[model samples]
Target: MAYKAHKLLEGYEKANSDNLPEVNIIALAHFIAKDSNFISPEISNIKAMRNGRESYGESAIGYVQLKREGHITTVISCVAPEHKVTSNGYKVEIVVDSSKGEITSCKCYSCIAALGGCKHQLALLGWMHRRFEDKTPTEKACYWKKSKLSNVGKTIKFILVKDLGSKSKEKRKNMCKKKNKLSSEIIQKRKPKRKIYKVKSKINVRKDPDGVSFLQEVIAHMDCKLKKGNVKVIPELAKIFLPVDKFDSIDIHSLMKDELCDEVAKSTSNQTDNPLWRRLRYLRITASNLYAVAHCNTVNGSLVDILHGAKLRETSAMARGTRLESQVLQIVSKKQKMIFERCGLLTCPEHPIFGASPDGINENFTVEIKCPTNYKSYFNFIDSSGKIKPQCKAQVQLQMHLSGRKKSLFCVASPEFENNRKVKILPVDYDENYIRAVMVKAEQFWKNTIGKFVLE
Candidate 1:
């Protein structure tokens, strides 16, 4: 039946027909994953040839046969149009055998005897390759009219593409199930219930000033000497310094420092009037910089800023958050019977340069208060179980690691949302690995950078 249709096109477009290289089905399938360039003469040529062919007129032939793992067969009538033929053009057959890594049959009238191939045969191969390779479910269904079945042929020329779309839906459903199973395994491994406590605290630690005078005070205090020619490393004062080991010193100031910002900057890179590139180029990591070290790759900029004595800019957001933190502590203290001790920044005795300024602490648990300006930010700190988010988890864990407390309670107090202002205690456990990695960087920064600069 396939060869019978090819016979009709033997004399059609006879002048243009010539010997062409054979379409190797094996090489074509391999290229499908890495390239989509097989549609060489452009889609417009295919549509134009289909429309111009007077013999095939408006009749359509659609055959799609899909096999599991090793085989695929596609048969299409008028797969290659011959100019002004007496009957319907040729039918093309493409058969791919994965086991043999070859296309067993690639037949079309133009170059059937040549074994190599013709443009019509190649076009059919491209269509079949695309159909088997595309794995996205159909976004919308293709509708055809029953009364005008033959007329619908023009629009529904590539039936294999639509068939693959429907097939892909089944493939995707199975994939999603496998993904869920893997995710379940991961969650089970990390499943430790969080402990909660409704402790009341009235203590409020005010936000310290960030100015030249404060910097002078911190440096002067570090100048305090012991009798044995040893310098006192005050953990309380260490919070004011930027820990260098927290962030990449080289890439920190580059144009692509922030991934989100990098994407935005790239789209606007061609704009001559944009000042973003210029501004970003000169931006420096400073002591007064307020950023999330727990959520990002690097530590805060305080260490770098202090070493170079960069000018500090006071931010209203930091001041507001700090003030709100104190207010939250006050409410917690009043509601609960427990008292939270007011404290300064505490550093590890071994790594004095690494400091943690926990909002409040008691004998049983340490406190880390968050005052999110918005509801989204507020909810980001806690999950459905009131456990801290993984990003914020590191922060509280570090606080516990430094304060010598096993349990750390994180409280979110958002004043803008009346229902969210209450201090909900979400106790986080200590992460020794995280603290150890941070301490190593802190040690390196202190000994190599800060030690040399300060000692000199």
Candidate 2:
């Protein structure tokens, strides 16, 4: 039974390209693997080709083999020079269909970016192209020899340019070192010369005045300006420069509250296009990101950078949610028979740096709406069994806390469902423990990571 199965598998295996004529193999390799920027002029592709050419010229390619099945051919090779200690380098494979006149796939087993095509595969391809370019139609040069790298620490102490191979005896003869009198003269002339200069050190004899003297001078100047009725000198400027008896005596909480209120008033519209809204949200750790901030494990990861005003490009799902939010809210309001009033950002009084901008708020509860882009997400929301996603739960809890409400309605909407089943409303009660834990993490993150960017 094992022999029969082996025979069947052998019948299905692709034929080795070694059986094909040398001319045909060379033609196929050249057609698929020739280096040119005409097909793809991207910088990344050009860079890969440049590195691959260097690898090919360095004789890094080893143990190349080809397999053919109908019109498709696959070239496989080992690239051995990339690693200093390991003899078995990355396995690179390139698949090409001559009938299509294009490479179907290229992969490097040891490369992280193998899915996107890597340099090792390109090195094998360039090696094939060099073989085709170097050999004539009538000459059948064998490509089965081991790579130069395979002889490292054995048979050869080191590899040199002269050892790679010489096409002509004259070229080999001219490879010997020759003396250049002109180069030696140029090097001698370019040598650096030492120079010495006299230096003297000086010290100031005068003593600097203290802070009180500078403050008295500033106060006297300001008083003189005020007495002259100089309208250019504003009273607010005097207040800023004036020295106070104690810094702790200032009402920082009231000042922060007033500043936050002013910002909220400026960004009351809360629309995405509003510049003030974007700017205000850009500075604060908004409720939507609370879950990520709470759960992040690294101090300087991408999440911290994002919170520090790094702009994230909008995805299709975000665009869809933004476009369908108003319609979903209308549907929920109509179905629930309650008016949901749209409100601007609500900042926490105690933690002024944290804020939440809920979808809508009423006398009893705040509302947060979600529009899932697909049926799977829609169904997941509908069949959640009184459990909410951690991120969504965190957002709603923060919204409820900021709005001073005890309950929030988590609504999910999808237009693809039937009209009767288009919206799913789940009532989420405010959880004090969860919100407290989240706030602790958020505070630590803000102090350790985001405070420098925001406060400075």
Candidate 3:
């Protein structure tokens, strides 16, 4: 039999009357809690319930319909808040045996977990339960109206004071023009006018009166006397001043120092084998994991554990890459005729929590070497045609950014190829927009996940 998509049932009367079918609210709660259809982690279940309640409150559930055939009652509704602008929503259908006080069948349409159950299904169940709990005899309000979530995408150009029932523009202008006499008097007294005066000199002096002699006297006063010797000199002055000719002859290169030389001096030395390298990258989101952090949907338990001091065991593939990294770098350097210097943990100055450690870096570009463990993986890298995998691309971009280089070399190596074709080097230019997006995700993860866990 061909599988057909489920559609909503028609001809059922809308559930708007005060008198509605009796539903076991407690049973519904028990189903959500223990039923295999809705089984999930406790935290996920809690989040689902919260989300369902929010959906119900936001009026995401449309007009519910109730139909009866013998002792079985069928309830149908649509959950519409999933999309911001679309009128279409997940259709939820529940079949209950009213005589047995149990839900025999429940399913939701357009949901991946429809056969079992999903948050949307649970939301409809919750909405029905809440409706049943209301003991008032008043007529139930119609829920056929559009959900509030649909309005989320709406744009408001501007808001006026009249829209908020505030004073009008004319009233405001009139109020600004009206001045109290007492207030005006107080303002005048608070600000006093500046007074102008004319003066005449009583004594006459020469235009130039021994200026050089006065300067000499000032300099002489600044001079200090030695305790035991008859020598006068300025305090804290250099003991010996070299002549210009002698200074010129001295080595200026020896005196000039590079400030960053000290900071990155040990950078190339901290590799995976070093304990300091792991410690430095322990709580930081490095370039390699930026893609995962950005595209993560739920609490990434593995990543979270790793962030919380859990050691990541190197896989066979990773070990292979590590072993071949140096060989790949050598091949690349030999072919490209460029000195590729190894780099260690390089952190962003503006965002300290984010870091990167490129395989190699030089004056022109940073390098990232990948040695695939299998031929299939190697071919996949090759098939990319210079536009590498998104994760690898993000890693290269971040490495370039962290190393302060405008370009990067993505090198791929495989043993099966000939020596001349052993390694492939692709040039990748720095992408500011992509880097900014990655930084935003990194910051969110650092603050929300890592920061929260540390606080706990």
Best by TM-score: 2
Write candidate 3's Cα lDDT for 36-66 as tens digits: 6665546467666675573344456665677
Q: Of models 2 and 3, which has the larger lDDT?
A: 3
Error of 1 at 372 (Å): 0.8
Off by over 4 Å in 3: 1-268, 379-386, 415-421
Residue-by-residue lDDT tens digits, candidate 2, 1-456: 221211223223322222321223444345434544322446455656565564443477755566778777776666765446235566677676654445666667866756555666667666655553443335444444556766766776776655553235665455432235446646755877335221111101111122122112222222344335543332332222223243433332332344545357335645566544554554367888898888887887888756645666554457778877777888889988989887676764466557787888888888888877555456444565657788888899998887779999999876453354487788999898989899888867766664433221
Model 3 / residue 73 / CA error / Å: 58
TM-scores of the candidates are 0.35, 0.46, 0.42
Tens digits of lDDT, candidate 1, 298-378: 333554544344434433335567557767877777766678875444433343334455677788777777776544346
- Lowest-lDDT window of 10 residues in candidate 1? 198-207
Better of 1 and 3 by lDDT: 3
> Where does candidate 1 stray beyond 4 Å?
1-303, 306-312, 334-336, 383-387, 415-420, 445-452
TM-score of 2: 0.46
True-vs-predicted CA distance for residue 55, candidate 2, Å: 13
Predictions in order: lDDT: 0.44, 0.59, 0.60
What pairs collide in candidate 3? none
